[model samples]
Target: DQQVKQNSPSLSVQEGRISILNCDYTNSMFDYFLWYKKYPAEGPTFLISISSIKDKNEDGRFTVFLNKSAKHLSLHIVPSQPGDSAVYFCAASEGRGSNYKLTFGKGTLLTVNP
Candidate 1:
């Protein structure tokens, strides 16, 4: 079973619109949640994160909400721009410890058309 899954492999939206990405996890032990954005070849860069302690976290143009009971998380980008076109990955890990290993979902590729 996939511990983490991004059901949509890709999303496309017009520029200056809202882009939403969804993610789901089955592991209840995951306490740290993160979202990363990746360009063509470079590694993913951290976008935002929310601990199991919080239900929401937001960055400049990005926002993440976590629903612990449902084991679901979503990323929202308001007024999405062309630069936002890339693959987004949802990651999860346990609290800092030896067992802490970052697990990533396949990814959702978002394309913003101008």
Candidate 2:
């Protein structure tokens, strides 16, 4: 079973528009949620994160909202730029510990049209 799922494999948007990416998880034990952005061959870079204790977390142009009750989460980018075009991976982990193993979604590729 896929504990995490990104229903949309790709999204296209005009530059300076809002980009929204959605993710869902079935595991109730996942406590830490994170969004990572990846470009072509480079490794993923952490964009933002939210603890299960909190419902939302934001950093500059990036915002992540988590609905613990619904087992869902979403990432929003305001005024999305061409530079923001990349593959976004939603991941979950138990917590910060030895047993922490990140479970990643298939990924959502965002294309910002210039």
Please, what is the whole-model Cα lDDT of each candidate in the order they appear? 0.95, 0.96
Cα misplacement distance, residue 32 of candidate 2 (Å): 0.4
TM-score of 2: 0.97
**How well is each residue in 10-97 modelled by candidate 1, as lDDT tens digits?**
9999999999999999999999999999999899998999999999988888999999999999999998999999999999996778
Each model's number of backbone clashes? 0, 0
Query: What are the runs in model 2 whose C-alpha is more than 4 Å off?
Result: none
Model 1: ten consecutive residues of lowest lDDT:
94-103
Best by lDDT, which number?
A: 2
Tens digit of lDDT per residue, candidate 2, span 1-114? 899999999999999999999999999989999999999989999899999999999999999999999999999999899999999999999778887799999999999999
Could you tell me the C-alpha RMSD of candidate 1 in Å?
0.9
RMSD of each: 0.9, 0.7
TM-score of each: 0.96, 0.97
Pairs with steric clashes in candidate 1: none
